[model samples]
Target chain A: MKIRELLTRWVGFVALGIRRTALRATHTARQRIRFSGLGVAVAIALLVMVTGLSVGLATSTTVYDDDIDYWIVPDSESPESPLVATDSPQFSSVHETNDRITAIDGVESSTPVLAQVLRVGTNESDEYVLIIGVINSPALEDVSGLNTDSLTPHDPYYGDGEYNGTWTGDAVLSEGTAELLAVTTNDSVTIAGNRSFTVTDIESQSSDVGNVPTALVQLSELQHVTGATTYDQADQFVVSTSSPAVRDDLEGIYPQSSVQSRGEMTASSTRNSDMALALAATALTVALVIGTLFVVTTSGLELVADRQQLAVLSAMGISVGSQIRLVGAQTLVLTGLGGIVGAVCGIGGIRLINAVAVRTITTEPIAVVSPWFVPYGTGVGLFVGLLSLPFLVVVTRRVTGGKLG
Target chain B: MAGSVASFDEASSSVVVSATDVTKRYTRGTEPGVLGRLLGRQSPPTVCAVDSASLEVRTEEIVGLAGPSGSGKSTLLHLLAGLERPTDGTVTFRGTDLASLSRRERTRHRLEHIGIVFQQFHLLDSLSARANVALPLVETGVGKRERRRRATDLLERVGLGDRITHRPRELSGGEQQRVAIARALITDPELVIADEPTGELDTEAGRTVLQEFERVAENRAVVLASHDRETLELCDRLLRLRDGSVVDQSPPGGSQ
Candidate 1:
């Protein structure tokens, strides 16, 4: 027979089989179908949630926000290596670089940032916190969600490399950090145990950075306090641009530096995280196995129970290929339903996980389910359903082997 | 019925199915003894289900296979239906030897030319009587509407027009058997095989089924396996089996 004709016959057989099986299940086999579907749903939900967490962790550790289009860091520093960004000994004249980058035609705004880990405390006790120093610029407003008005009422005067530059001892503390220090607006906090700055704002931490205690300070004040002003150096320059063409200009600014886009940074971070990838792969394999086993067991049992009916069909001249297609169709329907349910539950699971994290870890969300995961989960569920085909074919051949009597 | 048989003789040509020295053997158990196991060479125990049974069924003829339990009546039916391959000798349908066809080709031949009925009715419990009748046509790639129409007509012909929408469980034994018969004729096959088709029905229901079989046997060959004398009386001829072999042949009304 032609492929088209065979397919047409198989399709008709499967459609009728699915209808009959579904109807029969409603009366005699409801529990088996329900339990199998539930098993598939739970497996897919776990897979989706774990994948979301892996992606979320990767994004949080690398990209800080969606606003900054490009980051200019030392050529030796890679976004995949957070340690490279934080602990690298190389430094750049970020203020000058920012000034040069800001003058480019397509550049929207630019800022120089100095990030350091320092001991922060009250008069009695102290704890380690990440202190990020930023020059007051419009890019800070767009990238950091920082309230510039609270950091400094007037712009700093340190761009000219003047030691007598005006200093603003104003600081912004993350919500968790402020909670730990027990301070509010206008309260004085000690940075590195020497300089005391007044907390002008306490904002919730960005989910991108997780639950690390962090505070923002003026770049000039931080430079003066940390003694980074001998050559006027900063860690990296963050640049914002409406057009991607400015990447060429940013790259030409420094011969020894690399300019990276947000996507590149995310990919780099995910590629380097062996632990995250391993955990995600393990979760996926476990989910696939659990889901496939459930389908195999349930569908195998169904085939056994329906063996006589299959024999009858065979005796009535139905082909073995059509019988296999019948089972395949039934499996697809069951798993397809499970996939939809799982995707919905997984989205809710993401929310629930984030809610719990906020209470326990003080982070907004450590997991995020992207919109694409819906179709992805469904497709995986179907693949898992397809995995049960071998078991189904074996069972079918055994059952239909002239056992009609 | 006699006039229909005479008309079939005038219109039909050649035999629908012929079996010559057919034998079917089944292995009963695992091989015995240590040497047999080591050399992988033991016949074990075997039973010949059908031993050298030869028969011919022509169009318009209803051939009855009369035998006691375990007398290989069902086995012979299976061989004729191409559901099982004979261990020895040949079984041919319409001049084509069954052994010459591959497994897939045999299945296609059965789908296109053979229909079978089981004693248990074997109707899918999920579908209505009409849908059960239409089950065979699904493999033919017939359109849904046409299949339904033809199935409905077959059901009506079998006196099931009012019960067309009833599920198997909703109908009586006789009604369900009628539906099975309708299913058997759905493809308009050249041959129809039934294995104790009326074994589960009451006397009146069995009579109704036998009458329907006689009616349908006008244009097609039917080989039915039954131990019931009344049912056997409906066939144009009867072949009696004993110990897996045909022991006697009875003309119409000879056993009655």
Candidate 2:
């Protein structure tokens, strides 16, 4: 019975503390509520935006929008690294490996990709553009931000290692590259100032690849131009498969190559690059430090100002534990309110970051807001409130030490 | 003057609280710092707030602690109310030593058996007069409906039924004190301690509060510290203090 009574009293105290805190918050909305809440909200907003930007930059290495499940890159290179211009020893037999990978049960299709930076120019100026050579397959037809239909009627004979067999001087340009070169469909451009190719189509800027200037040509043409015809060499293979078992098969195809699933590729790339994580951690630390300072100082001052009221409660036999809980509840209510406002501000921050990035750096957004960040931001706010608890307890104890006056 | 008073009806009334030779001392200034210690400095001076005071408060009596400013009346009242432990003596409430109880246990004892009122009428500014009355009951785990009903009844009894919804700032000083009295009596404690409860009120308002105190003192013991003669006249007995010691103890109608 005694235990039950104690538990009941505790429940009553918590409920009363919550109600009183909320009432006091609303009553003193101007002096108490707005001061701490707005400070915390701004901090959380900046943290959320920083986190979004970090995650976006970390995941931005996925340049292919096609539903390719795995990227087979040379072990000496990374998928997230800027396209490797030089061929590795493993790059020599990629075409033969691609053919073998297509025979796997779960492997729906495979294509060898050769990526190189070439200086393509107009009569007025010239600029370096990334050129990717891919086989004309159904997988390429469905790629986002790429118009491969214009390359159709040109069959899939590029991997045959004979550039003169079925030559079509057809090439596609990314909208960004097209704009940079001031070229349109049917406009002719010189590759390395030797080979001429017609721009068959212009694809828009893709979210996966951002605004990097890029061009696509037939694999055989790129091999012929890059002088890799001796070994049918390519940089990497893009494989589309629905089964996890295909990963093991792809990993064994070459001695000095790696097979990475989409998520694995993202994690691997992000893990190797510490700059983004450091930036995010720094942003989070700055935000938490600012928020903790604001809450502690404001709450400490408030407690000192309200010492007499706490003394009155103490005199009336209210327990010290209850008083501390009251302070905690008040802190949480303020920070929670701030969290809600911060979430809204964070969304706006994400948009502003994207807009600024498009103008200054990439043609796509530099930051993308994850839906989970809403709750993460709010939870962090609550954690900050909890962090302010020890300071509040010290203040309360000092103020209510057996003195009413 | 050095003796204690036990003036209530011996056969019918029982002691609710008793204090014996209670002395409370307070240091005057900050403690000596590291430089002072290195120079062999002495500690801060001390003053006796309450000195060797003895008293017994029985049920069915209104005991007034009367004195001038800094006469130790408030300190003595606090000692009797178990708000502070005496520096050199013991206080027992209902046969249990308050000094022996843990801080948590003492708080629980006060919550269950003692109610205190302050001179400043420390009602939460945000809570309504009714909610203020119900505040103690909330600690006792009373249901909301019952807490509200009892609070409303007390407010009506204190003649503030119409002001139940009013916050402390909206109410007059007397009304706030009445609300404090209602809050004190909400838990129906065995003893009620008030420190200059009427100090902030006018004569008319003070009288109304005194009348409510008289009503509340019919069964439980009441110990009020006040300098007002009008307030003391309503007490059954008065203990007047001077310079941290009790100088006189007598019935209000008798010579001190």
Candidate 3:
């Protein structure tokens, strides 16, 4: 009941404030309020857009396949954001590790992945394509967006851990690679100078981390061609599992590597967290400073101009506390409106960034927008209103000096 | 001069407001800052706006304060209504001394017990006539629907029902003052103080306001201050001031 009464009183005060603001006749006062709202809106928009960019950077992944539930990457590995890291610490004897992980209960399939940028093209032209070698299995669907149905399963090219097995010469090319090299599904392309492969399928897909030309091939074949065959080394292993408990087993399989679940794809879990967080923090601070300053400055000017009105209300027996509440309600209304507009502009900014990213070289979305941005922006706006109260209180007290009593 | 308060019938026992030997003095020069105060600067010249004024009115009495310009009519009204505390003496509203309370408490007491109509028709230009009339009710924590209902009814009573939605800037001077009167009466205050309420209006508007006051004065006690004799003629009792002191009064009382 007490809560209800407080809400009722606040509603009354807010109604009074809004009526005054909406029906006010002075053009300067209206312009002041409009500029304050614009300042808050622009600030919130920038904050939300910057946050979306940070989220996009954090969620970027090299393994684009949806079914891959976990990644076992070396703990010392660097930058997965934008996924252009050339070399990093590798997991040795990945075949042994993959076997151990696949034997775990609830495990669907485990494929050790090795990524290397290699020149793959016809004799006429060549393009440096990101080639990911994964041992395709009946349980796997795709790798780096390349469909794995046509690739030889189980990496038959590795005969008893030796390079003596038959080379399948089967490759799956992304549409980017197909376009870059001007090749089709039946075309042949040579890689690493002496090794050649037949393009069995062409899929229009970009690397999940960012847009890039890519191809998929059998693990051992590329290992032999790239000299990763020394210890059956691979950059990481992608696991498709039905149970989350398999993450613990994957973690224990390789002592030097860390198991990354899909849920851990945030800035904090990534190596580039400092940069992403800095960008986000800068955006927040700028919004805070700009928003708070605008609210205080505009409200002060407005209250000063309404000094006579304040005096009149004081004469009408309005206590200073009640007067503050009325003014506070007006500030909240102003900032709240600004927040809604800012959130909309921010969402549009995120979409624009994503669209431009797709049309240009960055084929994947580099910004993420969420529905919660509206409420968060409005919350910040309310905070700005609260912050402006001390200044407004001083001004009110000046105008309603003890002379009235 | 201090003991010259007029005596009337036994109706003083029911006095809604009583001012006894009230004096208000204002310093008219530059007040000393911290440095000047530290240097023992002399006090500025002072002007006594109200000096040893005494009067009282009972229920249903329409008391008038009449004097030429600068005769303290408005100052006495301000003191009586608790808008400004007297520098000396006491002002009691329904038996409680107003000068003994804090500024906020005094203001609250005025809000609850006294309603005032100013000479300038000080209605907020941003608010509609109905909203302006409901301004006092807002401070008293009245609900919006009820405030609106009461304000609209009061405006209708004042012949401004059609102008409820019109902003002050859109209303004529007489219509604005009428709205002010409705605002003053909305609180059902024990005493209504009008300081030259019709001073800014033309003869026609002033006559209309006087007629409204005649109707309003039927049940409630009013203390109206004006220099116009015609305006004061409507009062049941009259107090005349000269140089901030009440020199004469009518209705079988001597300078009450």
List the global CA lDDT of all models.
0.80, 0.79, 0.81
What DockQ would candidate 1 receive versus the native complex?
0.52
> Candidate 1 has what TM-score?
0.80
Q: Arrange candidates by TM-score, descending.
A: 1, 2, 3
Worst 10 residues of 1 chain A by lDDT: A77-86
lDDT for A35 in candidate 1 is: 84
Q: Which parts of model 1 are misplaced by more than 4 Å?
A: A10-28, A52-59, A63-118, A128-165, A204-267, A289-305, A332-354, A360-364, A386-388, B1-12, B31-34, B37-42, B123-138, B141-179, B201-215, B227-234
> Scoring each candidate complex against the real one, what DockQ results?
0.52, 0.45, 0.44
Sort order, lDDT high to low:
3, 1, 2
Clashes of 1: 0
TM-score of chain B of each: 0.91, 0.92, 0.90
Off-target runs (Cα >4 Å) in candidate 2 are A1-25, A64-178, A184-269, A360-362, B1-13, B30-40, B127-167, B170-172, B202-208, B251-256
DockQ score for candidate 2:
0.45
Tens digit of per-residue lDDT, candidate 3, span A1-405: 266545656667778877666654243257767787888899899998998787666544456467878888777643332122245578777777777888899999889999888988797888887788898788888776677999978888886767787789998987767877888988899987779999999987643343456789999888888988887888888898899888888878766667887545443333356776778878888888889998888889888877877877888887887788888878888888888889889999988887887688554467766777889888887788888888898888888733421
Worst 10 residues of 3 chain A by lDDT: A77-86
Worst-scoring 10-residue span by lDDT in model 1 chain B:
B6-15
Best-matching candidate per lDDT: 3
For each candidate in turn, the TM-score is: 0.80, 0.78, 0.75
